[model samples]
Target: MTAVADLFNLKGQTALITGGSSGLGLQIAEALGTQGARVVISARKADVLESAQAHLAGLDVDASWIAADNAREDHVERLANDAMERLGKIDILVNNAGATWGAATADHPLSAWDKVMNLNVRAIFLLTQQIGRLSMIPNRYGRVINVASIAGLKGNGPTSQPTIAYNTSKGAVVNFTRALAGEWGKYGITVNALAPGFFPSKMTRGMIEKVGIEKLAERAPLQRIGDDDDLKGAALLFASDAGKHITGQILAVDGGVTAV
Candidate 1:
């Protein structure tokens, strides 16, 4: 006899979002926080994390943040432990931290390739493992939201900005979501991913400038790029009880671009 709205209510839940200082991470934090979940955000820079915490407060969202680079193992371990200490238990996790590099395959530096793969793939596995083992697995209840990209779903030709490493890393993330979802379901945890299209963020600034926002928008049937709020609904669904029966799914929030 649960009320319809009660399914989406997160009054007692808590979430930890990596790379949450800005962009889509910030947006997802807002979505979950506004719905009544305590939120903790993490990123590499202290100043930016402070700013994001302040912004969340302005929205009346109970939010906190930690400054940590997910690319490093030490930082990942500390982030997981500290977040659990701060929130008691994490009912939801958003693996939103990521990195990208743009270079032709031939000229792509090995160091840069390592950087992208480390953050986009390795960091995700580590954090998810830490959080899952410590919190989610013990509770037998959890939600994991991975932030993937449309680039992972398809390949880009030479005409577009060359980002082979970034693309490859994201593709790994897509499959990682599927593989983990299959394994974790037995533990009463649901793992899902969000594959977003072009949005106005620091990560996409270069691509947007090179191709023009209008041009990118035209690629989608919606004829518009994603807005700040585009991911809120889908994010909420996967985080709440509304998505209890769903897992191993990658929902694309790309304004119909992938549909075409």
Candidate 2:
């Protein structure tokens, strides 16, 4: 049997993370890098990527960054090619770049819906297709971790923000994980998703302020929101050999909010 430590060891592997300049994307980047993987992170802001690279360097992680806007097809294509060139072969891909727009279903603008879908769903499809075709399929070994949300698993209650477009896009991502896993498993590529609940990040700052962190905590059985390190173990599991047999699964990192 492979030793447990060996299962989780990523010493020689490499990863590409989207929206990795900050928030949960950076969090996952830290997890993968600390575990000995060389990582290439992408986001739209060059300055932010520079800061993230410095932070990773401080942690002794071999890291690089490519700035690209996933919402644009041309940028996404360039990001894929650039990341592959830097890493040589991407053994893992983390689809963490996304967006959210808050508005009542009736009041939501069509442009906002497109924005959310373009970043949250279409970008994922495009980048994953590029990486899989470029590196994973040829090598026949890969791990894909998509960042979904607990919101995708269920509908919003009366007290929650309307966020019709955001909810719809994340729901698409949940199934997208399953469908892609099935299609790629034959090629020895594993696809899975991490459905995180309320965490303090730039994207959720407005919601947290409106809903109040205490109120949000009350909704979960754990009585607390996610912290900086909460997603590390789960993400590392899915990215490493430890989760090789695990595919087409959605692991919710919510603080037991979905349970109740």
The Cα error of candidate 2 at residue 137, in Å, is 0.5
Lowest summed-lDDT stretch of 10 residues in model 2?
A: 159-168
Candidate 2 Cα errors over 4 Å, as ranges? none
Q: Which residue pairs show collisions in model 2? A: none
Q: Which regions of candidate 1 deviate over 4 angstroms?
A: none
After TM-score superposition, the amount by which residue 147's alpha carbon in candidate 1 deviates from its true location, in angstroms, is 0.3
What C-alpha root-mean-square deviation, in Å, does candidate 2 show against the real structure?
0.7
Give TM-scores for every candidate, taking all chains together and pairing residue i with residue i.
0.98, 0.99
lDDT of each: 0.95, 0.94
| lDDT, residue 243, model 2 | 96
Writing each residue's lDDT as its tens digit, candidate 1 over 113-227 gives 9999999999999999999999999999999999999999999865788899988998999999999999999999999999999899999898888889999988889999999
